[model samples]
Target: MKPFVKWAGGKTRLLKEIEQRLPADFDEWENVAYVGPFVGGGAVLCHMLEHHNNITRVIINDINDVLIEAYRFIQDDPGPIISGLKEMESIYNALSNEEQKQMYYTSRKTFNDMDGIDCQKIILFLFLNQTCFNGLYRENTKGEFNVPHGKYKNHRILNESNLWEIHDALQTVDILQGNFETVGRRLLREHVFFYLDPPYRPIVEKGNMFTMYDRTGFNDSHQERLKEMCDYIDRRGWHFMLSNSDSRSSDGQSYFDNLYNGYIINRIEVTRFINTYNATQRRPKEVLITNYQPPQQ
Candidate 1:
């Protein structure tokens, strides 16, 4: 049950670190809801559903309405999306290299112009992710999808079985499209475990932020607001784990350490798999901050 789309700041590579830090009592907990505030790519979401049976309820929310809508489309019925992707794949695979490039831009325009929920929007979202540059999602200030074609060869644009698996996995889950605070307010009374993966702050000052995830970019102020939410969640005795870029790369700064004071923050090494804009901007470290100490393994 892998994520249906390629997402920047995906947790696939960090899953091992995340799993190792789960509360030791997690498996013993009953009827706990698993909440994902920034459910991009949904790698961790799928992983939790696959491995943790204690997570009887799941709530996933994102700021991107289109992405959430895609999730709903798949959860409700993946048949049309599957059909659209198969047709798209058949046509895309037969085109020449030049033809593919032209088709990519044209399809991208159509995707950008599209509004509201429909099967085609979901189809184009998945298609652009597979064919887009670096399998990355970027947007202009206007929120249009702006990644160029990746010129990939023999890419499997449609993974039919995986879609079915995702559909089945998401059957009982609750999906929401809103800001993180909205999610926080709604979960105030739930017995839940939270995994918060916000957009990575720039590794260096004003240099390489990947916060274009939505038209409304996440900035220092938003980070502060999230920290406030974490404080509220922590005071309520809820368990949460958060991931973000280690800001001490070149400037020797401890921004997150100062923000999440008194918490257990582990600086873990990570390979830069996808270079979004520049090669030099790919930092090799990230931090996992947890409110409660993970039990010894």
Candidate 2:
């Protein structure tokens, strides 16, 4: 099952690399729990639940309330969400290209001003993601949906079957919203698997530095906090993996090498940017850090 909406920094392209590098004990354990602290796009979460029979419980948490709300609406009941999508599709398809663009900005404006990702409003969130420029989620400093309208051909707005599949797969998933620390409370004695994909730190100083995905900022201090969480999780004997930028900082220093010392770090060449459509900003490499060794064939 695919994600309900297209997300920035989504792991859709890297799922295969991630699956091959999962902890060795995953197959050995009869009933394992899979957890993702920053489930942007949820490509990995869907993959794990769909492909692995050993996974009994899946806990997917993210800081974005709108994204989480989309997940919950899909999981609990996609009818309203689906209905909303159909309405948007009908209205969008009936209009001229110029009118569609006009409606797009108006819809975006309505979405950004709202405080919560309410049931009615969440569908517009999905619509904007589908029709916005390059399908990327970019908000301004004031938290407005600022991306221009995307002129894509024959976009599938309301995919009913896929949504149903996602809903069924989410039956085992517990969607939590808050800081990454929220998942710490759900830890247990069972053999647990952690896939932590926090927002990637900028490789170069002049980079856009996606300090804030929503309203709050995730800076170097947040990265440090993530490292600390990894340490605590590692000490607790939970198997874990993380993804981040592999580039050197502006000072020509390796950022993740020292942060994830004593851990296995593999560089994967990625053709797409972690969170953007800017061709100039697309870095070639990404760091995949793991605490446990994968069983080799």
Q: Tell me how far the alpha carbon of residue 52 in candidate 2 is from the true structure, in angstroms, after superposition.
A: 0.8
Report the Cα lDDT for candidate 2.
Answer: 0.81
Q: Ten residues in a row with the worst lDDT in model 1? A: 275-284
Q: What TM-score, computed on C-alpha atoms, does each candidate reach?
A: 0.95, 0.93
How would you encode candidate 1's per-residue C-alpha lDDT over 93-172 as one tens digit per residue? 89999988998999999999987758898899899999998788888998898999999776789999999999999999
Candidate lDDT (C-alpha), each: 0.86, 0.81
Clashing pairs in 1: none
The best candidate in terms of lDDT: 1
Best by TM-score: 1
